[model samples]
Target: MAELTTSWLGMRLESPLVVAASPLSHDAEAIGAAVAAGAGAVVLYSLFEEDLTEELAAPRPSGAGLDPYLRQIEMLRQQVAVPVVASLNGTTPGGWTKYARSLEAAGASALELNLYEVAASPEHSGAELEFRQVDVVSAVVSAVEVPVTVKISPFYSSVPAFVRRLEEVGARGVTVFNRFYQPDISLDTLQVDRRVAPSTPAELPLRLHALALLSPFAKLSLGCSGGVHSGRDAAKAILCGAHVVQLASVLLERGPGYVGVMREELSGWLDSKKMVSCEGVRGKLGFGFTADAHAWERLNYTRTLHAGLPPGGGRPAGG
Candidate 1:
């Protein structure tokens, strides 16, 4: 049988499939099932800075605010032998990051900084936004003893350069491409209807593209998130050099048992390819691994525009 083990953020993972931060992790029963089904780790639903700030500002009873999150981390560590990663979602760096120390003390194996924000201000240059995020990572990494990984969006002007900054700031790993939830307008009510849609298989390519570009040269462990749903998807991610594959939507739709299925599928793929282990095939198709680097970059765009030419090799009738 092909070995399914992989290392991520300096932790040994029995499987590359990780339970992404979502409501699924809110319930201990769900997380237990996932680990039983071969999930390598679980990232608890994020504790937002706004919520932390509000709870800290107002008077509340002990064990009422961030206490539950800390307890959850402690509870999972006791229940499962796998790593329990705590997630902190915020846009800015502040005293709120002090909670990271509490989380670490609570026995969190690692910390994933979910850097979520919409850079809608024209006054703020891309450089400014990027620097702010780097600062946040630095603050958290400095505060925690455990490894810190960054979950970032793909909107940066240069993803690799931004990741380099993160590496310089001491982030242990980087998860590619956080999904930005957009609100829809309700035509009848003439108001914004906030709805978070589940990720589809279509979203996988965007992650693959980004991973292929970064996997070869980045010293930080790369994690692929946002669109993985099958064994093939997981394999594709690993092939592009992802040290781990994070999935939330598929688990939500199919339940935690799906982790075992995806793991089996990855193992079967490795066997068919005559590969001995998951790590053996890692980055086999990444930009650096490929013979033509430009093909994975600009050439891909040109081919996509000319995917299916006319019979006479000219533009279609409409054009």
Candidate 2:
């Protein structure tokens, strides 16, 4: 029989299909359904510091308090058979520490620190801005005993260095990127619309580069998020060196039952290749084992030389 189970951050999972933090994990019922639908693990909707502050700044009955969120997560973990991770995002060190510990105590198998802050302060330099994340990771790591994974944004001077700092600060895992919701312009009123959408398959190339950069670290479990659509995508991500594959936008669009589709596609691919388990095919094509690793890094420099007016413009002469 083909072995589908694997371990993520030391947590035993039935598959690599992790339900990335989304509204799909906001409540116990949703999580229970996901687990039933064959999710390897689940991440709760990120408890955003800014959103919580706004919620607490003024009392609102429509909002669920922190305790309720924790309780719901605890209830979720009990109802499911896979590892349940609670996600915490914050702007302040104290908030990260407090909430990380709270979630850990609430029966969360692990914690994901979404350390993303828009660097809008003019007084903050790049180094100074990143220092805040280092401090926050240190504080949160010290506060909780569970495995801590930091999901960071790609906006940085050096991604490899940033991931290294996170690992040095006791982070057990590093998720290279998170798909953030980009605002859209409404042509009618000329206003900003804040609805977040799911990612598509076109994003694989970018994620492949990130996985290549971080794979050499070896110790930290690297997870790739954004644009994972099928089992083929999952296999490609693993080949690129992602230990755990995070899925969200796709699940949101196709429903939790999508896990079965991914499983079918992945298993069929393995059968065609005569591979039995995910481990047999995992990281097989990674930079760790690749011959020409330049293909991932030489992207920008090579693209610059392609003499052409991209897409809607004129094609360049070669002959």
Candidate 3:
């Protein structure tokens, strides 16, 4: 078997496959199963800023406060031999950042700061929003001893530049994208409805594009999230310079045991290609590796347009 070991956020992972932050981490047993099935690391479901703020305003029920979250971190450290990463989801820096220290003290190997905010206000400039996010990350990084990795959204105008700022503020790594759940308009009830849908293979390209762009210049370790469904997909991500392949949807659908299956597929693909290790294929397809990545992208765009149009040009088969 080709060596699957990968170094991510300064930690040596037995494999590049990491279980992403999701409800799967809510169950200690489920997390144990994932680690047993070959997960290199596990990111616990987010401890939202709103939850912390609300608890401060008015204490929630007994089991629904910061104490339980901290306890969960401690418990997971004892149960899983792999790195246990704690997730904190918020946009602004405030007292909530203090919890990052607590999380580190609770034995979290690292922290994933999920900066999930919609830039909905025209009043706020992109620069201003980006600055605020950087501040938040700086605060948390300064507060914790554990390595901090930011989970960013794909909506940023200049992803590479924004990531540069994060790196300056002591971020050890970055996950390419965070999935923002969209709201649906309800015709019958005349209200906005919330829906959650799992990501598919189609979503992988966006992550790959970002990974290719960032992997070359970024000093921080890169993680690919969203749309990784199979071993082939995982191979594509690593080829684009991702240090780790973070998965949640497929595991949720197929159960944690699927982790072993994906690992086998990745190993099989590497063996077939005669690659000896994950590092052997990393960044071979990234922007920096190409002669002219911008020109290549433009050429692909033109080719796609030319091949997509039918003779009449009404619509293509899939269109």
Best by TM-score: 3
Model 3 stretches astray by more than 4 angstroms: 309-319
Over 30-64, each residue of candidate 2 has an lDDT whose tens digit, in order, gives 66766776788998888877767877788657645
lDDT of 3 by residue, 1-319 (tens): 8999999999999999999999898789988988998999999889887787888999988565678989999999999899999998864566548778778889999999988878889999999989989999999988888899999999988999999999999999999888988788999999988878889888999999999988889999999999999988999999999999999999999999899999999999999999999989998888995677679889888999888865878554576
Residue 256 accuracy (lDDT) in model 2:
83
**For model 3, what is the C-alpha lDDT against the true structure?**
0.91
TM-score of 3: 0.93
lDDT of each: 0.89, 0.80, 0.91
Count backbone clashes in candidate 1: 0
Decide which is better by lDDT, 1 or 3.
Answer: 3
Candidate 2 has what TM-score? 0.89
Q: Candidate 1, overall lDDT?
A: 0.89
Q: Can you write out model 1's per-residue Cα lDDT over 1-319, one digit (the tens) per residue?
A: 9998999999999999999999888789999999999999999988877776778689556443578899999999999989999998864566436878888999999999888878888999989888888888898898888999999999988898899899999999999978998789999999999988899888998999889888878898999998899999999999999999998999999998899899899999999999999999999888895666665677778887878765777644665
RMSD of each: 4.1, 4.1, 2.7
What TM-score would every model get versus the actual structure? 0.92, 0.89, 0.93
Using TM-score as the measure, name the better of candidate 1 and candidate 2.
1
With a 3 Å backbone cut-off (N, CA, C), the pairs that clash in candidate 3 are none
| Candidate 2 wrongly placed segments (more than 4 Å) | 289-296, 299-319
RMSD of 2: 4.1
